[model samples]
Target chain A: MVKVHFTSHLRHVAPSDPVEAAGATVADVLTDVFARHPAVRGYVLDDQDRIRLHIAVFVDGTHVRKDILAAPVTPASEVYVLQALSGG
Target chain B: MAERLYVSTRKGLLVYARDAKTWKHHATHFLGAPVSIVLPSADNQTVFCALNLGHFGAKLHRSTDGGVTWTELEPPKYPKVETSDAAEKEKAPAVAQLWSMAWAGPDKPGALWAGTTPGLFYSKDLGATWELNEGLWNMPERARWFGGGTIDPALHAICVDPRNSNRVAVAVSCGGVTVTEDGGKTWRVAGKGLRAEFMPPDQQFDPVIQDVHMLAQSPSHPQMWWVQHHNGIFVCTDDLQSWDEITTAPISHFGFPVAVHPKDGNTAWFVPAKKDEHRYPVDGNMVVNRTRDGGKTFETLRRGLPQGQCFDLVYRHGLAVDETGDHLAMGSTTGGLWTSPNGGDDWMLLTAHLAPIYAVRFA
Candidate 1:
């Protein structure tokens, strides 16, 4: 099981509390999470299914960049979805 | 239960309730972010708030319980050009903020129209999904347009004809105005008779390049349109084919929000301020000018308003009148709220502190 947690900025869009979803990889966990709360899909990802520019996703405390959801995940992996503390 | 007012400002959203004799500040939402625009559905059960996060981009939040709680939804974003070229990003227009919003009416429940910087967007599924109206965005005149006070040219005023859902008119600051008869499919620039003093004398009346600050067409009178352009005020009496400038104001012709009487198309109210020089109230005195005979003459209403040392300004959506024109509310950039319960005859200060107000909508 993978634990998926959302940042405070996105909590209003969906439950921020970490949720458990069965998955062997980050991609599968994200698919499971998006399946449960579809409204967060657009905010976390763009129209091309790529992570939004300001959004950062990490698996087991390690940030994932290009292969957003391809990172391998163990049962104890913790996924964090956060908006980068940024300005431009 | 009294009528409620929704005020959006640079700081947040403020809600107020008014009874027979007094106004009460009720609640505040989005405590920190700049809430540039907000609209309450006719039924008052649902409200949509547009927040402009400086670096995070634009966001839209909906409140089902009269603004007590909000659910952030996917806001309108600049469309990704279908082109696979890497340069597509540089050419795409940037969406600065969701400056304005309106309901498509009960005929199409959950349908919404959003007016944003650089273009317009429409949502059929209650803001969950949005599609940019590329027809208006692709016009050749876009390259020549620019913003006045705002950072970028925007579709500030979206007047949807209640009589015909397909007929809609939008006003863009520095980009003039456009009317779409096919429900956002195709658009025609409709700035006839309006003049822009800032433009070169040769192109002042071209209609497409005029600096239109605001546009208002009362729901009761769909054919009668009023445009508060940057240079002067105009009224369209011939189905938008042409307009007549209302040059009878006692003060400057430049202003922001123009509130038309809900029932009487000939009657309207406007806030007069100095033009590009200062952008504050004319003569450093705040006053509301109302026209009852189609702008033939404007009676100045400033009974309880600040008489001297008042320089607050009103935005395009900052002055609003409820279903009954008698209940008028206006907010200022200096965080002042004023209400006229007797149809603009007399006014009273509601509050003097909040934030730089962006919009005032009475429900």
Candidate 2:
């Protein structure tokens, strides 16, 4: 089970705590997460089914800047969705 | 929770209060279009707001009784140009939109400065009358068009050293930071250690050198200042003679606003957005980072903010620190308005479902 933590603002649409997903890659796990939390799908993925520019995924504290969904994931890994922003 | 909050939106300004545990909206409707920037006097009695009206022209509005009422200030008119030779008539300086306004002293409350899309203007008697700072306009670089067409060099940010009225710094969008030692009589470029090279043949002009978005000065250290550029964040010392890069964060460099701790010179704050996207909140997530030791390091603080997809862009004048020095408030494009009393660790929404917020202030 990969520990997926949704932020406070996103919790209104998804499970607040970690969710289990039987997948081998980051994309697979996120696909399962999105299946459960439909409101969060368009937020992390674009209309073309690609990672959106503003959404950044992290696997085990390290940023998966490249093909986030395709990145490998393990049962012991953690996933975070951070907003890509610049100034205050 | 008992503190008062004020927010500026596309419709006007909204005042709010925290009751029990929920935020109660107090009032709204003060300006037209979007209130791009808002500044509250140090006494917490007077408020100033910059309204963006697109090509219709922009103006500033002021409130005297703690935002209870507001009145629009007359914008400065461009002086008519004339030629002594009488052979050719002179055209007046092009009128540009107003971008930002700065008041030099909250103690005296009359010394004010306003920056526009084309140049800088000053008013010693509050907002009653104004004069153009010719030194800034006369700079040979200001007349040079970096990319084929002429750029207006919009003045987006301005900071006046609280300790010294004569010491002031102004940031021009598409123009770098400019400082004046003996008041606004003479100006100099403070663009050392900042990237000036623009990319692509057509876009090959230095936007970072010219387009400065936000700036903050340490009340304790007059020589120290922090700047937010369209490209990155920077720290400068010795009156902007030299600068150090502090944009190592994992956020995009194209942001609009930056704020410093009211009492701590080493602590500063910035809101980050996704670099590759539309430059709005990343996937609609709201995140702000605070640097306790100046700009050397930063940690993300999003405890109470939303994480869903939202397109809220915090403008250059939206973030402000309270007078009590215990709270920080910000107005967003989508999230309405929020306040964090304990710096940025925890936040609470002060208003709901307001227009796109352009600026915020406390009075």
Q: TM-score of model 1, chain A?
A: 0.88
Top candidate, metric DockQ: 1
Residue-wise lDDT of candidate 1 within A1-88, one digit each (tens)? 8899988887756686898887888778878888988877766765445566677889888888756766888999998988888642
Candidate 1: tens digits of C-alpha lDDT, residues B6-54: 9998889988887668778888999977998998876677889998875
Candidate 2, TM-score of its B chain: 0.85
* Candidate 1, position A58, lDDT: 90
Tell how far residue B100 is off in model 1, in angstroms: 1.3
Q: How many residue pairs clash in each candidate?
A: 0, 24
Highest TM-score model number: 1
TM-score, one value per model: 0.83, 0.70
Q: Which one is best on lDDT? A: 1
lDDT tens digits by residue: candidate 2, B1-363: 234566767777676654665446776645445566666675557777666544224566688886777776756545545554433322235334566777876554587888875668888776767788898878776764221112466776788878777778887766777788778888777767666434445443343344466777877666778877666788876768777778665555667778877677777778877653377876678888788887778888888888887677787777877655557888787746788878889888766577777676665
